[model samples]
Target: MIESAFPIVEVPDMEAALRFYRDALGATVVYRFPPDGEPLFATLQAGSAQLGLGLAEGATAGEGAGMLLWFYVDDVDATTRALSDAGYLVLEEPSDSEWGERVALVSDPFGTRVRLGQPIAPQPDEE
Candidate 1:
């Protein structure tokens, strides 16, 4: 029924936010409007999801917590380590959960919480 979705973040400075997404999160610029002009809006691909960053009039950047967007990856540890190495703030270390998932959390420059997770192999059933 649902077609598709993407998360949009409002930023005061679109260029700086775009740089943060591209450098820290390892996102590739998929589609950017206005060519070489200052980016008022841009789309970036992080893993499978498309993240949008836009500049709005009189918008002040605020640090927000408790809101998290989760992304599924093949290797949680590797992704986390790479993000950390790229200067991203690692909020949580990679750890396995009882629910059969390995996950890590990080914070972006714009204060967006991102969760990276990978499913773990199921345990054998007891006889």
Candidate 2:
């Protein structure tokens, strides 16, 4: 039984990435390595979602590719609009999906793509 999963995003600049996660995505830094010194690694929380940010070197070198982080919210449209207002890049506008979800895609300042989704209630069967 898995307890929890934390997605780690490696970035070239840790401070800038931290700012984007904290200010743009509303994530709070829960823990940081070297507490008093510069943070090379840190954990953040937004509600129940936990995320890890680290320097892009050594084992973590490379851009966020072939991975799409999904953040589920109450209102996909509202969140998308808010993100747009904040100057984030909207990769895909909010829209209904055939799989019964309202979803939108956006990219962080560092090119990390994230998908925001809200589950749609199932409709009554047609007679």
For model 1, the local distance difference test gives 0.78
When summed lDDT is taken over every stretch of 10 residues in candidate 2, the lowest stretch is 56-65
TM-score top scorer: 2
| C-alpha RMSD for every candidate | 3.2, 3.3
Off by more than 4 A, model 1? 1-4, 57-66, 123-127
Candidate 2's TM-score reads 0.79
Candidate 1 local lDDT, 28-106, one digit each (tens)? 9888776788878889998777988888775543246446768787899998998888787888999988777898988
Give the distance in Å from residue 95's predicted Cα in candidate 1 to where it truly belongs.
0.6
Give candidate 2's error at residue 35 in angstroms.
Answer: 1.2
**How high is the lDDT of residue 108 in model 2?**
74
Deviating ranges (above 4 Å) for candidate 2: 1-5, 57-64, 122-127
